[model samples]
Target: MRQITAILVGAGARGRFVYGEYAKKYPKELKIVAVAEPNEERRQLAAKDHGLSSNQLYESWEQVLDGAVMADVAVISTQDRMHCAPTIKALELGYDVLLEKPMSPLSEEVNTMANASRKYNRLLTVCHVLRYTPFWSKIKEIIVSGGIGQIVSIQLSENVGYYHMAHSFVRGNWNKAEETSPMILQKSCHDMDILSWLIDQRCTKVSSYGSLLHFRPENAPVGSTLRCTGGCVVERECPYSAVRIYEEDDPCNEWNRFITNKLTPEGIREAIEHGPFGRCVYRCDNNVVDHQVVNMEFESGSTASFTMSGFSHDISRTVQIMGTLGEIRGYMEKSEIVLFPFGGEAIEVPVTVEEGGHGGGDEGLMREFLKQVRNENSNDDQGLTSAEASLQSHLMAFAAERSRLEGGKSVTIAEMMELQFTQVKGVASPNKVT
Candidate 1:
């Protein structure tokens, strides 16, 4: 197999750890030829890891794109707001793109990106990694096979672990909705995509309710300081203490390394004392909801309810699907799927949970993306997640957010798309498609 060369746009955690690491493990299958990262340390680290020469290293994405096109694919793992321009430019430059999700925070931008992909005839796959996992894939197969008959309803919950919520939302980069995006788009877009994919129908309407409930100053323990390193009174008991989570003497595991590059005790202590990760969860500038519930009505008249909470003990997705003939219940963490047939014996399907991030979804998606780019696996059975197909989920999320803010008024997907089209009519080119 000819190796597929790639240029990385962002050398952040997702760029380097999730997507770019595939090049390291499968050197014969893929290669990272160039990298564009503003951070000097990260650029050097990525260059050294990918064995790229100095000429291949760029200080910014604009610099990489300013020169000639260098690779077959561009792994665009930039921040949410930064996805649109680079993605469209890469497609125009004759490079297939693997974009990190929530594709863009704005629906119009996502639509524009999708249109560019169609116009350029370039592959644009979003990193909806959950769809590539064996656990969810099996469920999809069972549903499609009529194991549960026609889908009637789905109840899904994404339980964001408390520590993770603190690390990413409270004290990390995605803390503010105004800056990054809403909690739904930033974190739960994966769930929304999964829900839409499983139902196999467009989301017609959505209603939601949520808030930034407990992670506020009023709920903080008395005598708690602004930062965990500020000698808080409840540092020992607080689960979200920055010092306890990041400054511990834990081994540098794959997950920990991705969060904070500084793994040593002293390094972690210094980061906490100076970085955003050290701020008290209750005292951060976060405005996104800590918990949310969305009710979706698909075009097929099937209903689904999704709940995202930041206070779970474990980070996992639990789903229950009801059909005309039976029902399916699954716990993503346990990798167990149970089928209950009407007046029949229950069937319990054992799912082999792969060992890696997102239940091995990161590697699964990377492999599928490489195959797609190489034209090795063109069949639909490969479950390739295209940018166009993933757009509905993002639209659904945008509508859900609107509904949530509008006092749970039911928001139709068509209305959201139409609004986006009108809003971007002057800005977006004439390649719009329904």
Candidate 2:
């Protein structure tokens, strides 16, 4: 095996903690050679971790890719909308890309990215890390091996968890749809991608129903202060209180530091009193839905149902795949799976969870990407979450969002594919579904 050099495009949490940690743990397999981050703190932090020289650090990805193809691959963990430009430029400049998911919120940008990948003949892989997890991999193996026969339907529940919803959707970087993406795309596209992969079929049609039911000004509690750190009458009882959740409990955690990199109690107090994360969850300007349900029809005539909610007690996922011969059910938090055959006994399987984020999927994805880049693995590997595969999932999310705004009207993927993404008053513009 050969060592593959990589450029870090964003030194945010995922880039620094997940991918950068991988390089640190296995320097022989992968090495981080350069970094391009807009923030001085994160950029310098990356440089320190990777031992990068001044010449190897750039303030933006444009500068990193402008001079030369500095590394074998560019790892793009930029903000949601920023994924397209750097990815396309890297491919054009003779570099493969490991891009973060929800490639783009716009259909046109997604299409342009796919075109760039094929035109440049570059290896483009989306970080659909869920597919690489031991839990999901076991499920895929069973379906491929015909352990449960032909796949008839799949049901997935994405429990976003209550505090997570408050931290991310209500007050975090993804607070507003216009700033980032709709909740479905930013948060649940993984679920959409997983469903398409497990069913091994294209989603033909999609319809969804959801809205910002609980996280809006209209839903704010009476007499509540604008910020949780304020002397609100209900501070002690509010579940989304910044005082309790951020400063008191996980003061030094990533989510708290995300609001302000200070990570100290005083800095957190100051941040909550003035910054976004400190605002009352229900009094904020969040427009994304707090809960949603999507129904999809696949090319094979099978159906799949997915639901995402912000009220779960734990941040986890549950799946049940119904097949012609039997059914397979699994809970991700437990890492336990059960197989039940027709008129047969139930069998339980134990999954060995590796020590990494996303149930070891993060590490698994990096491993596979390195193998592919080194020509040790096939680019056409059935498990590769390439740009084309992730494109379908993105389109599925767009169709679902269009359906949500149109009163759950059925929207076909073909219609979404045909129309260019435009924002004339709102997205899914012209309402042209022909």
Candidate 3:
């Protein structure tokens, strides 16, 4: 296989750990030729790891795009709101893009990116990495093969663990809807995408209900301060305590790396004492919902209901797909899938859990993307990662959020899509067609 040269647009957690690491693992198949990251430390580390010289390092995405096109693909893992301009620019600059999800918080921007991809005739694949995992992919395979007959309904629950909720939604980058996006779009778009992909149908209608029910000020303990480092009385006892979760050595082996980049005890303590992760979960200025439920009706008369909550002890997705011939129940945390025929004994499918992030989805997605870039994969119709294909889930999420905010009113995908097109036409230049 020819080495596919790539550009790294954001060197943060996802960019470095998930996508950039792919080049390190399979250097003969892919090569990272350039990078653009604002953070000096992360930029330097990524550049050094990818063997990029000073001339290849850029301080901003704009600089990378403004210069000559340097590589075959651009890996864009910027923040939620920052996905639009860079992706559109990269496509316009003749680079295939691997963009991070939530595409953008706004439907108009999502449409714009999709339009840009089509207009430029460049591949724009979003990082809906869940579709690439063995666990989910096997389910999709079974559904496609008619193993489960026709998918009648799907019930999926994304149980965002307590400490993870505190770390991410309550205290981290996606705390506020105004700042990033609604909890549904920010966190559960993967579930929405999965639901649509499994059903193999476009969503027709959606209704949702949820809110910031538990993490508000009234839910705070009686003597709790705004920050966990402020000598709160219940700091040691509270399970959601920042100091307890971030400062101490994690009992859970999988979570130790997430607590602090500095592996030392002193480094962890210092991060807790100074960083945003140390803030009291209940006292933070978080406005996004802590729980939500969405009901979806598909074009083929199939239905799905997705539940996203931040209070589970385990941080994983559990799905139940009911069909005419058999049923599939999967727990992502356990990496197990159970099949039940209407009349026979249950069959357990052995799932080999991949050894990296997102149950090996991170690697799987990169593998397929490299194949496509190298002209080895041609199944474009089933390409779940493409921007045009991924937009449906974002529209579903937008409609779900609209329904949640509007008292669980049923919102049609047609309405959302029409609104998206109308907005796109309103903002389009004279030479651009709607």
Q: Per-residue alpha-carbon lDDT of model 3 for 212-240, expressed as tens digits?
A: 99998988998888788888998888998
TM-score of 1: 0.95
Best TM-score among the predictions, by candidate number: 1
**Candidate 2 per-residue C-alpha lDDT over 200-308 given as tens digits, one digit per residue, 9 for 90 to 100:** 9989999999988888777777768888867688888887788877777553245675677677878888888998888899887787899999999999899999999
The residue-level lDDT of candidate 3 at 399 comes to: 91
Root-mean-square deviation of candidate 2: 2.9
lDDT of 1 by residue, 58-135 (tens): 988888887688989999998888999999999899898899988887777888998898888888889999998999
Alpha-carbon RMSD, candidate 3: 3.3
Each prediction's number of clashing residue pairs: 0, 0, 0
Which 10 consecutive positions of candidate 3 have the poorest summed lDDT? 425-434
Local accuracy by lDDT, each model = 0.85, 0.86, 0.85
Clash pairs (backbone) in predicted model 2? none
Model 2 per-residue lDDT at 150: 87
Residue ranges of candidate 1 with Cα displaced over 4 Å:
249-259, 376-383, 427-434
Best by lDDT: 2
Model 3 regions more than 4 Å off:
252-261, 376-382, 427-434
